[model samples]
Target: MQTHLARAAASVDTRAAIPEPFADDALVTQPQLKRLTGDVSDMTIWRWRRAGIIPEPTSIRGRNYWRAGDVRELLARLAGGAQ
Candidate 1:
């Protein structure tokens, strides 16, 4: 029936209008770290890590990850110190 079809279409449209779940905080990874640092090479980060320049990353499942907020804070601090 036309009414039933219209109701079905409206239901689908309503569902589509719902927003997808989005995370407020995004986790940072090594690749993101590289992008933030503007240094493409892992060796550069590795050297920074070894020299106690950058904060140590937290390891999980034998992989390392840095907090995005921490990286941002470090960048802000570095920028402030430079000026």
Candidate 2:
């Protein structure tokens, strides 16, 4: 019984050590976008979108979301240009 418990605990530990999969194309909401963008304000994000600096967002059920890949690509392009 002790060996069985140890094996079960080991299996649980192995599963815990595995990181969750992240989807690059997943849709992220405004709060998540703000977090990704270094905690920038909602208005700043809105302005960037309005100015055509960022990719357009998709709205579903009256909530807006942007693709994670799109945001990452935009940041990468901007960083490359800045350097």
Candidate 3:
């Protein structure tokens, strides 16, 4: 019974089994940002960008990326860390 349970657990597709491509402090693309931000919608990020709520992303060879640390800092500040 234990062997069968272990086999079933091994076969289960666990999302956490996949390794993240970047470190927490690394620059990340939009898709990575979505994952980091717990799947927040792209439209929300776009609106935040337009409203200057978040720091502007940097472009590299036509691709946009943001520093994970910067995003976290912004979120922390907005959560009233300054107060």
Candidate 4:
């Protein structure tokens, strides 16, 4: 059986992997997002979700997964104040 971590790694496409300072699993959870955004609240993330400002998550066995590339692109757009 594939280890849980290995499975998660395999789920991401090679092109979506983050290199350098950000770890392979850096953006794997909401808490990670909080760290990235300097304590951004869950409500803010949910609001973005409702507004379609970021891509919706993919659920595996009821767990939501967001690719790092998607998060990075969304963050970039948000930084540029682009809708």
Write down the lDDT of every candidate, Cα atoms only.
0.53, 0.58, 0.56, 0.54
* lDDT at position 77, candidate 3: 45
Candidate 3 stretches greater than 4 Å from native? 1-25, 78-83
> Lowest summed-lDDT stretch of 10 residues in model 4?
1-10
Q: Which candidate number would show the highest lDDT if scored against the true structure?
A: 2
Each candidate structure's TM-score, on Cα atoms with residue i matched to residue i, is 0.57, 0.63, 0.54, 0.58
What's the number of clashes in each of the models? 0, 0, 0, 0
lDDT of 4 at 42: 74
Displacement of residue 8 (Cα, Å) in model 3 is: 34
lDDT of 1 by residue, 1-83 (tens): 22322332333322222123423244567876665554346876676687665778988897778765566554554444421
- lDDT-wise, the better of 1 and 2 is 2
TM-score winner: 2
List candidate 1 stretches off by more than 4 Å. Answer: 1-26, 81-83
Relative to the true structure, candidate 4 reaches a TM of 0.58
Instruction: Look at candidate 1 and tell me the lDDT of residue 3.
Output: 39
Tell me how far the alpha carbon of residue 11 in candidate 1 is from the true structure, in angstroms, after superposition: 48
- The local lDDT score (0 to 100) that residue 66 gets in candidate 4 is 76
**What tens-digit string does per-residue lDDT give for candidate 3 at 26-69?**
87687765554445567766766776666789989988799866
The C-alpha local distance difference test score for the whole of candidate 4 amounts to 0.54
In model 2, which regions exceed 4 Å deviation?
Answer: 1-21, 81-83
Model 1 CA lDDT for position 81: 43
